[model samples]
Structure formats: C-alpha cells, structure tokens
Target: MAAATVLEVPGGPDGVREVRVSSPERLMWPADGITKLDLAEYFIAVADPFLRAVGGRPVTLQRFPEGIEGEEFYNKNPPKGLPEWARTVMCTYPSGRRHHQLVIDEVATAIWAAQMNTVTFHPWPVRAEQPDNPDELRIDLDPQPGRTFTDAVEAAYALREVLGELGLTAWPKTSGNRGVHVYARVSPTHEFLDVRHGVIGVARELERRLPDLVTTAWWKEERGERVFVDFNQACRDRTIASAYSPRPLAGAPVSTPVTWDELRDVDPRELTIRTVADLVRQRGDAWEGIDDPAHVGDVANAIALWDKDVHERGLGELNFPPDYPKMPGEPPRVQPSKRRKDREDGDYLAPKAERDAAWGLPVIPPVSPMLAKPVKAIPEGDYLYEPKWDGFRSIVFRSGDTVEIGSRNEKPMTRYFPEVVEAVRASLPEKCVVDGEIVVIGPTGDRLDFELLQQRIHPAASRVRKLSVETPAHFVAFDLLALGDDDLTERPFGERRALLEEALEGVEAPIHLTRATDDPAVAKEWFHQFEGAGLDGIIAKPRDLTYQPDRRVMLKVKHERTADCVVAGYRTHKSGDDAIGSVLLGLYTADGTLMSVGVIGAFPMARRRELFEELQPLVTTFDDHPWAWAEQEAGTRTPRSSEQSRWAAGKDLSFTPLRPERVVEVRYDHMEGVRFRHTAQFVRWRPDRDPESCTYEQLEEPVSFDLADVLGADR
Candidate 1:
C-alpha cells in the first residue's frame, strides 16, 4: 500500500474534489486490520444514508491518532489544516462559550474527517442554521446494573409506542454499546429546555407503563435492574452517535439504524464498519423519510404531555447533568444518600448560625449517643438494665422553647420529628440534654413501628409535617447528658439515671423516662417479655459507667434464633478473585413470593474461596430464578446492591445467582420489617430442609404486648 493516496469525493462545488488521505495503510481497527483508507472508503459507500443522518448538523469528531486501543479525544473545534470547502458552524455551549464546530455536509467532508482519524460522529439534534432550537427529540435508553441490552430494546419499543401516541414517528438505532437510542423528528418551535421537558414527559410515561422493566431514576443506586430512560440526552449541547458512525471499540462496531420490525432480530455486533456499508446498500436507510415535511412531528403535542405531567400529575423537572447550572424545580443535584446526609447535618435546612441558635442549651448539636456492644446474656454485678429501644438513636438538646434532636451520626433529626421536638419543649426541662430513641407506635399501639419511624425522615418540610401529625414519634429519654448549664456526661450511670428519672417525672405522654432494673432476674425476664413490644433487646450499664460518646460502654442482650433460609445469590468479596463476600438469604412469604431476608457475610478468606468453588456448579442465570429482579455479575459489585447504606454505597452488591436449591441455617437476632435487624450469622448448610419449606412461618414470633406497659404508662 502507498503512504498516501488521493480520492475523488463527490458533492463538491465543482462536482468532485480530490482529498488526500495520508497514511492510507495505517490501521484504524488494529485488531480487525482495518486501515485508514478502509474507513474513508466505508464512508464513501454509505454516503447517502450517512449524510441524511448527520449532514448540515454540527458534528463532533471522536478521533484516535493510533488505533482503537490508543488514546482518544473529542474534537469540537475545527482542527488545523481545514480545507476552504469544508464549512463550520458557530455553536454555543451551556457555559456561555461559543466556538465554530465542523459540519459534515457531504461525502468529501466525512472522508476528510476519516483522514484526521475520526472514528465516531456525534451530531447535534438541531440543524446548523437553527442551532438554538432542536428539531429532533432524542431519548437514550440505558441499561442499568443487572440489566442488559435486551432490556434497553424492550424499553425502546415501549418508548416508540409512547411517541406514537403523541403523533410523532420514532426511529431506533443501536448505541454501538450495550444500549439503544431512539429519535423523533419534531418541529423546531421550542428551545432546548422545552424539548428536554418533552423528552422527560415521554420517559416518565414509559416508566409508568413498564414500571418493572423501565426506570427514570437519575441516580444509579435507585435504578435497580431496569432500563433507564435517559431524559437528559435531549438537553442543550448533548448529542448522540449519528447513524452509520463507527464506534471506537474492538472490531469497529457501528451505530446502525434499524427499522422497528428489524430491531428485534438485528445483531448489533454483526453491523460494523466492515459490514454496515453493505447492509445499508442492501436494505436502504430505515430513516429515509425522517426529514420530510409531512413526517415532521408537532413539537406542541409533546410539550402538551409535559404540561399534563406538571399540571395534572404533579411530576416536575428532573436533575440536569452535573456540569450544567442548577435548574428550577429540579431535585437536589446530589445523590439521595448524600442529600439525606446533608439534611441530617442541617446543611440544607438552615443557616449555621440559626441551627446553632436553635440548640438553646450548653450541649450543642451532634452529641454522639453512647453505643452498646452485644453480649450472649445479661451480665451480673452492679449493672442497671433497661429495655433497648428499637428506634433512631437521638440526643435531645433543649435550652427553652427551642429544641434540636441530634442523631447518633451527629446529624439533625429535629426537622424529621417535629412532634418530638414539640413534646420535648413541652415536657422536658427548660434547659437540658437527654439521650434517647425516637420511636413510632404501631396502629394498635402495642408495638414499635420502625418503618413508620423511618418515614419521618423526609426532605420535604410539608411531607414531614404531614407525617409528624399522622405518625407522631415519641422520644423515650434513657440518659440525662445535661441540665441547665451543667454537662452531665461525666456523671456516673447511676447518678445520670436518678437525674433522668427526676427530670422526666410526671412528663407528658410523648416523653417518658426509660424504666430500669438492678436485679438480673427481672432484667432477664424483661428481655424476653419486651421483645413482644418491639423492644430491640436489653442494655446493661455499669452503675459507675459515665456517658461516653460513641463508645460501647454498655452491654446488650437480644433474642437469637436459627432458621433455614434459601441462599439465592452470593456477592464477591471486594478483593475480587470470585471469593464469596456474602450470600443473600431469602424466605418464602405466605403468597409464595421469595422475600429477601438479609445476607450472611464475615467469612474467612479461605472459606470465601472454598464457598466460591462450592457454589460454582449451582450458579445460574436470572432468567428462571425467583429473584430475577436482582440481575448481577459474578464476583462484581453493582449499584443495585450498594443502595443498602451509606457505608456500603461503594461496596459491590452484585451477586452470582444461585439455583435456590440450597438451604442454610442462619442465627438471627430478630426481624426489622421483613429483613433481619443485622447481618445474620451462618450456622450450617441444611441439606435436609427443602428450599420451598423455608417460609416466614418457621421463624419464631413473639407474643404481642402493649409498648405503653414497657414505658410504665399505667404507673
């Protein structure tokens, strides 16, 4: 091959132009042995359809100087050595910057791009002339964790139906990755934000129709195993890979457009730079009439759906990309966990001076509630035992009318439980700090309802107020940490207990001092008896133990029972190598639904590897598994599983699906809602226990008792 060659490209001012292709023998797809000249030739072959898709649009060139394996950069600015025949369009960015970008007007322009090592073409949804108003509404169907390309295809079909209802003709194309991209031609009557809202409206409707199979969650943690309808792709400056554009991947796959009927059977891998040109020649462009005036959709119709979403459904704007400026009506830019943390920290709720002033006492906010360590039995000798409250650990700070509830993590719980704050102001000492648990009673008022208590932690002040009245939380003060200006943290437990009881004597219904017993026999009796009232366990504090923040100075004893559970899946250890990190356990509900009970972790490295090998034969796909909703990769973590907690947010949640034929016995403390209160301890494999027999019925249920009795309501 020659070092360079000149080819006559059609569609020039003079009918044809000679474009010099330097390094024609240099490989563009090294693995596939495709040379730069081959790329230029491919563009020439598919020129008609390629120009229809990207012609007269501001196009970005994704270039790789070496082959696909080397470094790459996106070229928006017109590069050096620009030919006078090649045209450029001035484009405005979200950051208020403007620059002239290359426009792919003809075959010669595309050939020139190929000569510059351009592997992919990303074109704006608008024409070069009307750069501010988009003529096409594009939706990117992305498959989230536990989902696959097939899921995105399903979502795309559903989306097509949604667009059809709005009188828009939809076109489908492979993303050249593991997703799909759908587009609809619309009248350029609306600006970028309006078009973005239209896309959001359509996506939200698609999610509503196929709630199980699709999602519109902006955050990855909340998406689960569904195809995510990416509404933000229609925003200003965002673009998708133009049809017939080659992707910078192994084998040089192309983002090829396909007819609705052909989509189901089309194999994206088969449509590549080496083959797409011929495929386009054989069948013609699926979007042949996309730009026809008769086929153009009314932008007003799609915007109408957006109006309905806002006015009738109360659905509002979604989060924009992080790089964009904060948009109105959009939710907090941070992830849910971080947003909750910010709310808990009072960072979002109030100014620092205001929050500081709200804590009217000497003990400021963020007083870490003393923690407890678990013990097998209630310890003897100089110990005071109290019923362990199954609620949020909180520190109540009150100077007078103002009160602030501090969480164990030193965040504000004051806003979440407004009822508790009012109660503390009304009943507790004028200036005092008390460590307690914020709990909500069940409907029957017999047991504590942790679920309802969790519902109190809402970001919306209106919702919080509504829930506070509907599901009022009570503060059960257990220890006195301050009185007036006195800091009682250094005071002994015995002294604190006396002071706490004295301080809360004759307090109102919502506020009460925790009952304590010095006798071990009574403490043991209360441990089993209080479990029925949804009390967590028993906490025993030494008489001389001072109030130590975040320290496990107290001992706790809780009920523990073993049950055979189905081992549905296993997450790989963070260290990788397919080592078993934890096994997800499930139990059959009364309705035959397999409920995720919890997980069993904390295995030795040797046992982890051994279990990985042991479970290999039983590994299965999500297709037929009962927990098919949980799609996961073997030995890898996923966002679906990482949503469990803030600490576990970075941990791998993806697990290899098991056949649910194996049953293992696990020792659990108790149930919190449907799952275990803490990580269950592995007992032994129950080969004799049938997986179908592993139902919630087998677990021990404590007798119901009035929580008021535990709090000495009658006294």
Candidate 2:
C-alpha cells in the first residue's frame, strides 16, 4: 500500500502549494534515510528561520505517525482534516481546562504539519494574543542523574552569567536531547506567575553560585547529581522544545538555534530532521530578533533575585510539576517514609546546621539521606533484602586517620573518592560509619555506569585524580553506620547486617562487602539477577527495623510486569495533545515482524486523555502500516535485530502505527527482546486483544539467576 505520494510544497508568501504528500518515500528517518519527503524538505528549508522561531506562537504538534521509529502524537487541535492555512487558538489548562490550541502561522502551517505527522514544534511562552503574559523566559537546562552532557554545558555557562546579571539576553538551544535550552526575551509586562518567579529567581541564583554545579531539584528524588534549573518553564501552560523543533530523538534531533559561539564545536547531534534546513541556512537566526526587547534590567531583575532568595536567603519555593497545582511553599508532598510516619518516633536529630549547610565549608555531620520506600509487592514478611547499587549514595565516615566521603547532602565527598577515602580508612574500626554505594565498575564488572559514575564529579582535582585511576570507584559497604565506639543508630536490621559483616573485615582494594539475605526466595532471585550487575532494585530491610536516618523503613523491590503493547507513538501532553507523553509499544516477531517493545509511561492519569481519545481512530501512518508496522522501515533493522542487546547501539527508533487493530495489555518486568526491560504497567485496553495475538511468545523467560551467591564472590 505504500504508494500515495504528492508534493509541490514551499507555498507561504503564497506560491506553488499542492501538498497531498501521503507516503512520499515514507521512512521519516529509518535511521538516516529521512523521508516523508525528507520531513517536507525540512520545513521547506527552514521556512524563514522556522517561521521566525515558531511564528505567531500557540503551536504544539510533535506528531510522528510512523517515523523516527513511528508512533508519536501531540497535536493540540487543528489536525483532523485541517488545511485552510492551519490555525486555531482557545487554549488554557493547568487543569482549569479549556481547549482548541494550534497556531504556527506559515509555510502553510509547516506544510500542513508536513501533511499531518508533525515531527516536532511546541511553542507557547505566550503569544497568540497574550495567553497570560510571557515573552519567553524559558531556561530548561535539566541533566539530572549524576548529570552530564558536559553538565548541561556547564549549566549553560553558569546560566549565561546569571542571565548576564539579570539584564537578560540568553538564547541558547539544543535540547534535542541531553539538555540545554536557555531563551530570555521577557517583558510582556509580567504574569505566568511572574515569569515563574523570574525563573525562580534565576534558579536560585544558579543554586547560589553553582553550589556543586547547580540544581533546582523539583524532585527526581531531590535531583542529586546536579544541573537542573528548570524553574517550571514559566508555568502558564508551560511548553518548550520549539526553536526549530523536531526532537523525537534518534538523530532526527533539531531543537537547534545556538550561538554564544556555537558552543565549543557544537554538535547537538548535528541538529537534524535532516540538517536543520542546512542549520538555519548556515547559522543566521541565532534567535534573530527573538522578540527583541533589549533589557539590561527588568524581569524585575530576576524578580529581585527571587526577592533575595525569598526574603533574605532562606531561599524557598521549589518542587513543582507533579502536574502542577498545590504550590505555594510546597515542602511536604510526603515521602521520607511518609514524612517519618508523621514524625515523633525519635532518633533523627542530625540537622547540624543543615549538615553544616551541606558542606559549604562546615564539616562535622556525616550522614542523612537513607530513605528508600518505592514498593509494589514483595513484602509479605521478615525482610533484609539488600543489593540496590546503581551508584553514589555514600556515607562512609571514619575517625582516627580522618576519612570522610559523605553526600545525600552531607556533601564532603571526601574529595571525590580518594580510593573511596583510602578504602574507608584502611578497612574501619578506629571509629567507623558505613552505608554505601559509589560504583563505576564496568570494564566487564558492571555495577554502576551512571554515565561512568559521572566521571567522579569533576571540578578538576586533576579531573578527580584522573578519574580515580582510569575508571576505579567501588565502595559497596551497605549500612553499618558507626561501628567501633558504637552509635549504630539504634541498631537492628539484623544488627546492621551483623555490623556490616564485621566492618568489612579486610576491606582493601576500594572496599566491597554488601550482601544480605533473609531469603525472600533469595530476594526474589536476586531481583531478577540484579539487572545483570548494574543493579538498582532489591532493598527490603525490616530485619527488626531501626537505622532510620532519612527515614522510610527501607522497601524498594523493583522490576514490575505487564505487556501487550502495540500502541506505537505518543508524546506532547503536558496540557497540549490533550494528554499522552508515552505509548510506543509494538511486539509480534516470529519472523513476521513488528518488534519495538518499550514505552507505556505509567498511564492512569484518569486514563490519560481518555487513552489518546481511544487511540485516535486507530491511527496508522503507513502500508502502508501493513498490519501494524511491519513490511520493514520505520527505522528498519531486524531478523529480530540480532536479538536485542538491551538496545542503544546505533539505536535511533520511533513509534506510532496501530491498524493491526488495537491490542494493549501492559504490566511488564524486564523482557529484553522486543524491549521493555522496564516501564510497561498500563494493564488494559485490549479491545478483545489480538495485534497478531501480541507475539514474541507472551514474553516471560527471565529466570536464570545469580549474583554469585548474592555478592559474597569477589570473583
């Protein structure tokens, strides 16, 4: 069925425009093939700097019926059979609901959204007739999990010197993936909650002058590995990813728009969707007159540095986006074991001046954040599970030879792992403390590769002693918390795993000993064999409870299940596509083909936009979707793609195809073949199931287990 093609695009100031473009060499980027007529000749070769950075605003599109691995969605109206020069508006939402949306304004509304499969473009920082005042104050920057992408390009050059001391003029870009957005042209005379508290007073003055490389947390479990800043993307129906849009990842990248001297040899995955219309015709619109306002002052000078960090330096207001609404001094959205079962069961003390203000030269308090709680089955008795390590929890103190290593906000990361503070000061007992993690490994060992354990959090101490001797980090330990000269935080947990196995006996070579067991069928078969060594799962506890530091009588469990998938493609729904942000699920393959098995986004947000308006009329975008995306091509590659290696090796995938006629089911718990090694959970929408009886043989084989007798093997 792949035959419908029609073209003659480029018609804006009104010229040619014939556009039917149905399957014009379809592909969309079957890994570097780029078609739908090369994403409509890249918006007709950067239609005037992509309509001067999303023309009259209100936009939202991001669709991808079946390219860039297919199945993407988000239209914000004007989609059904839209054409008369595409436009719409109404909007509103923060759940105060309202609708309509779409506005783009030119290149025939991005070639009528490249003939309905829009690839990327999410405008709206207000404009579409003052949608609540905002003239773009954006920021984004993101990069959490022990951060990287050169730590959001050094927190975007320290947020471009705090938006040049609050006069404003940023503009950066490349959030095609791996963070970095920036923006800045404000003055719509305030509101969108005052440009989100002037981006939370320039992200708390760049987290008080890069305090250990910036963070504005807003949850991801208190963003520990830095570079966050996101300041509710100026709230009022928050939107971003627009400057020349196109980021459904896998090298169809292009959240382009750079400069500040093309960021040290820029390469935002070479801004694509086919070279961002020759990178905006060889760099001309570095946000040309991006709303040109010229302001060396007023965003009320970053809301007077967030009103001097909320009335004189106790810096408040953060943690939003849990689908907004509840804000205003937000601090207690529970967790910390339900805020320590509403406090009062003693033994917490610690706040030594907030652990000497989390180490901006204060010292002494060495341990706190021990939290945990993220359950879901596997807790029917006794406990003591252990194993979890995906890197960096630390604690580790020592006394008579003074060792340190803290973190979880007690900071002093003993100068970034000096061989894990000289192997916990030559294996404990001259006064100790333990609780561990730290990791890195991977030279075949593989426990933590939080991107090579964030290259030992560098600020160059000889690049953290040359990445602690070329990739060497190790810790492990696992809860002992003060051993010699007691203080085992009110004991129990089978006596801190028997004094963390007698303080790691001869803990030499970067310290290790962290196993545990009270058998829950060997902790559910070492929680699916510690995801082949890069762990992050089993931590049950309760062997008579106690050690409650940052509370949450431990729990964790991990690996969940459910799988039927096949929905394919979804994104854009934080108040736009009416709801989605995840779907891409495909499966089939007993050679007949269909593959891609990962994507479900924990749905249940009141059945997420009514399950994309119940799969938006079973959207198919090609032979043509051939029984639900098969006759190869939405980023082709298979004979079961050489038996999937937990993906990502020249990956570049996308999703969105359904006409095999509905089938969903979801629940998952590590699969590996057609993907889903995590996130599956939806569990419904079957329409009497049968997307080819959802194949890959109903997936269940993940039993063989081993963690070498649960970590007792230094083998």
Q: Write the per-residue lDDT of candidate 2 for residues 399-499, one digit (tens) a residue.
A: 66777787776677788778777766666666766777787765555334566776578766988998888997878777775666565666677887776
Taking all chains together, each candidate's TM-score versus the true structure is: 0.49, 0.25
| Per-residue C-alpha lDDT of model 1 across residues 424-459, encoded as one tens digit per residue | 878998999889988899888889988788778777
| lDDT score of residue 187 within candidate 2 | 64
Error of 1 at 479 (Å): 72
Clashes of each: 1, 24
- Best-performing candidate as measured by lDDT: 1
lDDT of 2 at 432: 68
Q: List the residue pairs that clash in candidate 1.
A: 637-652
Candidate achieving the largest TM-score: 1
